[model samples]
Target: MTAAQMTSTSAGDGAEVAAKGTTEKRRLEGSLGVPSIVFMVIAAAAPITVIGGNSPIAIGNGPGSGAPLGFLIAGLVMILFSVGFVTMTPYVKEAGAFFSYVATASGARMGVGTAFTALVTYYGIQIGCYGYVGWAIGDLVTAFGGPDIPWPVYSFAAIAAVAVIGYHNIDVSSKFLAVALVCEIGIVCILDVAVFINGGPEGISWHSFDVSHVTDSGFGIAILYALTGFIGFESTAVYRDEAKNPSRTIPLATYAAVLIIGVFYTISTWALVTGAGASKARSVALETVSGNANMMIDMAGQYAGVVVRDIMQVLLVTSIFACVLSFHNIISRYQFTLANKGVLPAALGVAHPKHDAPSRSSILTTVLGALLLLILVVAGLDPLGGVFGYCAAIATCGMMILMLVSSVSVFVFFRRHHEIVGNPVTTTIVPLLASLGLAACLVFILVNFTMVTGGSMAVSVILALIPFLAFAGGFVTAAASPRMRGRFMANVL
Candidate 1:
């Protein structure tokens, strides 16, 4: 069979394909288990970055002390989404995550559309991280009395670093990410424990979860921002090609990623609220956020002393690096999957002969990200507000849409394939609920997009439309080109 025709059937088939003497068609190397997979997925979430970088805005502009409830709500929605998502993984034969699952249940046209959408989602987040990491490095340098360098210079440096790591086998990135994830989670936990021990000025309280606060006017925006922290969690399935015992690993990693991210965010946000006194949480958040500082970091400085605070400042930069590396791996694999299916250049489909990694695709992803960064520089946009803010808004919105579509696809796929024998609660009921929740998130994001992007109504509208445009572009390409149609129409499932 031709390389394009040999869709990925098993995560353990790498050696089989190699032994068959198909030197021209090496598959991605596999050996990753649950712990490794969990590390990568959680790193993509960048827990420290989310709490330190994103929590201020969420607290000030969202539900204030009630932000923890938003995390809880978003986590529950994701758990429901994962119920159907992981349940369908055993039947999918490819590592295209959203692309494979949607295609198997829906049609080639929609599958191709989803592939395009997934690309937009991952690339958006990756590029945004480049912007944030650039800003982060610049801040760290100045804090240490280093010369002032342009943020773009830092961004390029980070892109180069990620490119080097990503060109290696998945195992290398996984190990590095595991260490970074530990440090990121560690600092936050230290602060949490400190705040709990002190009991704050108001003496520890659950005021953040009060029904009145959760039902506040800003709760919708709180949920929107909270949901963004979970952006990369669903990516557990994207690494399936490199996973050992993927059917079990993917599900375990997915649940662990969701639960850890949810509980961590909830507790940390609550700690901040308690540390500041629930009544003063919003005011404290506004003071920090408005002055371009992180509320969590400030809280850490006050509760855990300058030592832990300094460590957090450094880890914040590393956290963004971890985010970039994790997303880089994901996008490269997606490109490899698309290439194997004939949607992209066939050259991108091949794994590295020595590393067994998607070297060609990784190079392309790096180039694309650099080009986007260059555009932001030439356009003279702010690394934090312009590049990070707008790009992150786009990524978060696009991911919500993908999750919604994936949820519906799960229900439809299971309903039609009675032979699969999935539990009704997980397959039908949970997915339907997940679809509604995600749809609400997408709508809320669109309606209040200016809040997320910190851009004008006009720019927010334009940025919001890009995901749909990408999906349409792919669907049209599949429908118009006879060659692409034939490739995309393959019944891999």
Candidate 2:
């Protein structure tokens, strides 16, 4: 609860230059406080996107009325994960987040491997989001009697928009995300309240929280989907360099993001179940998925009338845009940090002189996104079914790996630094427990990977290996270059 004082190491090259009274080396400029940080972090989660898109699939495939419990459980696990995660924030000061923390606690080589995996995590999720939002935009246009535009066209346009925003300073992106976050969350909250007040067809039953429902046969699948909705909550730590009081701000923002995501998803999902009676929830969800209908839209029409439903439809697209924009900024910063360490091209390390933003890296991210979109399109893959489904599964698997490694790093780092005193429960026990929990989540995703991707087990196995392959890629890059290996060691260890 005391403010985390910035140590020399934690302050990074930016502070070093500032202390030396030189403007020769430009760094990212920012003064973001907790609220702004939370806005960006939660924006990545895309509240409306999850409730409208992921919720129906989860409800159909998983525990039916018990889907709400899945989110609640996932939230609790992440909260435990954060206990140790935030403990390391005061120490690992770079924007690399997962990779930086693991590198500091573990080793430079392992950190590089983690860095590769982190890239896969962010890129996969962002690309998947692009596919989804593009498809959403196309659908919206066609609904209004306009000619049906190809999804990739819209996807590329969205990539351009994100690239433009990301090319500016973090402050610019944060403000844009704040507006989108409020509007999206506001609309969902209005629907949630409307559903609760009307008491739905089932008279506001709490059957969704029943123990029997939660422990049902499809609980694993339910948990996996629910956990996906919390994907970007960990990005809170990635904004460390730009934050006003990173030590305290990072922890507070992280906790707030997780709590907000957890509480919001749990309530909104339960409302979905309540809007349609518990018995009918699963069937309706299945219908929504199979028939390609929007359950939230239908529910809104029923509870809040047509105008609200139409507005929800539009906000859904904006929610996805915000999600991708947040990821674009995060990935750019990761590239910036890696470039600074010589893990990537030196050009990527330079921030824009005027904007003090990762302009070069942001451009790199945009180009990668366009290329990914082209690859998916050329493969003749369906945007939602193929791109979103496959990529999201890959991302979910990769993120779980990052979280698990990060938790272990926390434990290892504390054990090695015996002189650094802290609470055993927060610093030690919770991390180990979190690792176990996250490991289980990883296993669940692998075991039921087919359910998530909705593809053949052969494809599932291939997609699931991407994260590990990316990790191996990191190791190979480090070993192949002695200079880079030395650089990694000098910077992290």
Candidate 2 residues 1-493, lDDT tens each? 1223323454344555579786644356578899999999999999999998788888998888888888888989999999999998877767778898998888777899999999998999999999999999999899878898889999999999998999988888898999999999999999999999999888786978877875697877777887899888888877886888788899999999999999999999999998988889999999888966678999999999898888898899999999999999999989988887879886788888888888999999999989988999999999888999999999999999999999999999888887677999998999999999999999988888898888999999999999999999997888788878676655453
TM-score on alpha carbons, each prediction: 0.95, 0.95
Q: lDDT score of model 1?
A: 0.86
Backbone clashes in candidate 2 total 0
What is the lDDT for 140 in model 2?
Answer: 88
Minimum summed lDDT over a 10-residue window in model 2 is located at 1-10
Worst 10 residues of 1 by lDDT: 2-11
Q: How many clashes show up in model 1?
A: 0
